[model samples]
Target chain A: MCTTCGCGQGEGRIEGDEHPHVHEDGGGTVHSHAHAHDHAQGPGQRRMVQIERNLLEKNDAFAKINREQFVQKGIFVLNLVSSPGSGKTTLLTATIDRLKPRIPIAVIEGDQQTTHDADRIRATGVPAIQINTGKGCHLDAHMVGHAAERLNLPQDSVLMIENVGNLVCPSAFDLGEAHKVVILSVTEGEDKPLKYPDMFAAADVLLLNKVDLLPYLEFDVDKCLDFARRVNPRLKVIRTSATTGEGLEAWVEWIEVGAHSAKVIRGEALSSPPCRA
Target chain B: MSLMEGMLRIVEENARDQGFGHVRTVILEIGKLAGVEVEALRFAFEAVADGSIAEGAALQIEEPPGLGWCVECEKESPVESRYDPCPLCGKVPLNITGGTQMRVMALDVE
Candidate 1:
């Protein structure tokens, strides 16, 4: 399976690439070195070159650039991740309704295919851009960088990136956000944390959504929280329900605190002189 | 697929920098806690690297065991899963200290 999408190994086509195929090596070597000359020096003709670079080094570099830009602009960015139908959009719209009066906000909505979520966000009177991943599952740092550039996100504002609806893929890709918020609804199984440990482990906050429906369900809240904590000890959880407007205050306040910190960082950066080494 | 493409891009970049025409093998150091599925990576690499400089290149993965520092036992223990508690004390969450490596350690090029 592809870690980014959970698609079948030999089935799905990755972005900008065709299906896996073998090609004939038709003697394309341009070198004219004598094989016997190096044969005495090594056992094989292949030379070992050490790189010692991280696999995500390229993505991390892009993410670092995005992070620096966000910090400089005092933008508090949150990468919202969750399974589909976890009320991410509903919660986001509700949260925006509350925060928009006080703070400037922008959104980047990612989906496999749709301008619908972005349209919904725009309906809330905020700037939003939709990134259709096509066959891709998660939004990578490169895509986020391009989207951020296009959005021209304002300073001292909250930037919400609603990632592609998948509990698996988004956990590995960091989009230079200040935090990764994972939302799990009550309709889902409580053992989700244990089943998808990577997503729970990667998240800083877990929004236990659809708490309003808890009365009609057999979902164990304590067990769910415990399971999430077992995967990630410091994961802050907020019981939220967009329909009932429950826990919206705490969630909004949490965003405010983060946004305030970003503004403070910007203030400090403005006051300090650039250091030269 | 993204990871495989990233690895191929790195290889291509290094090929240009180091003056290598073809890659024979790509060595990776993948930790047990790196969240990478090796089988998936291997499957994706064939497609991602096809017709590229690393086409037909062999993937060699070196898996390192996950290590966690148990606060209750005041010792480090090998942990297979992240949710596992202190193997020694059987209580409290163990602080993950190792086995998150996901690096392209080396390459065999010609």
Candidate 2:
């Protein structure tokens, strides 16, 4: 007899039990016992529990925690995504030189193999860490975790993570960045956004680099901008040429604004949100 | 049939060695650009698990989104292929970020 639900023996007991149970009611008592005959077993009688959990949920959770940590530290972190030789290193060097006197900056460079980019950043007098993702197409939260621990970033500095040069894998794994900046150079065609919509759609800012080479190349700024807009209507596009320092001031200004806003938001003094407002 | 049966036999022996009476469920993470065919994996699972502890176990597959990072812009973009350019930057030679991974993230057992 089960005390809890007060249900009958047949209702409470599961099948294939050998012990017999007696149930008492107002009318009389009923008894049941396990049978000796073999039960008809199906081919696949094992039971399975269906769980609906996203594989990336673990990574996203880590990213959120990192984001909160960045907020607490009052540091603005940007994840820079672009192809190799698109001039990310050059742009970073220039940006660091331009912004160092006013705002302190740090960089975490990811590549398949090389301290070359980090060396370049170090030349600009900024602390940088080179993470070589050998044979791996992307950098995960674990790598970012290690980088954060190794970099010892300042409380108020802007930290940029230069992910491995691949347009596909890094976007799925978030390293807890405040902004995702996509760099498009003039040498690359205008249909890039259409070809890789996912990356464009995920970026907060779209940077059109190598604008100084615009006159020399066949790259159409308007077509590229239009395609990027078509993929991501809210993406902010900034044109820059690291070679001639063209449009770099505007880029620096944008970074400064982002740094200020990040500080305000982290301090809980900003009434409006950083991304939306 | 022989090849599938041999695979199934190996699975049964492995399950028995592992002391699993019956497998409840199996979960797999397949990347979108990982070059793995979902149908092929499913077929293999069915064939190999036919007479093993995983015989009736439910197979669950999850595909996480793909992403790529642009080295030039220092930005990470979501992507679907190795040949796709940076979405934000429109530049080739992108650092591939995600979507080519295969792993068993979880399993349900008795």
Compare the candidates by DockQ and give the number of the best one: 1
Please report the candidate that would top TM-score against the real structure.
1
Cand. 1 Cα-lDDT: 0.82
Q: For candidate 1, what is the recovered fraction of reference interface contacts?
A: 0.60
Candidate DockQ values, in order, are 0.40, 0.06
Model 2's alpha-carbon lDDT is 0.67
Q: Which stretches of candidate 2 lie over 4 Å from their true place?
A: A1-45, A269-277, B1-110
Chain A TM-scores of all predicted models: 0.83, 0.79
Q: RMSD in angstroms, all models?
A: 8.0, 18.1
Q: Compute the lDDT of residue B56 as modeled in candidate 2.
A: 77
Chain B alone, candidate 2, TM-score of 0.79
lDDT of 1 by residue, A99-167 (tens): 999999999888877689999999999999887676678877756775777788998999999999999
Q: Candidate 2's residue-wise lDDT over A179-230, tens digit each?
A: 8899988888788887776677678998899988888898888888878776
The TM-scores of all predictions, comma-separated, are 0.87, 0.64
User: B12-89, model 2: which lDDT tens digit per residue?
Assistant: 443443434566677777778655567866776776576656787777778877777787899988876655678887
Please state what fraction of the native interface contacts candidate 2 reproduces: 0.03
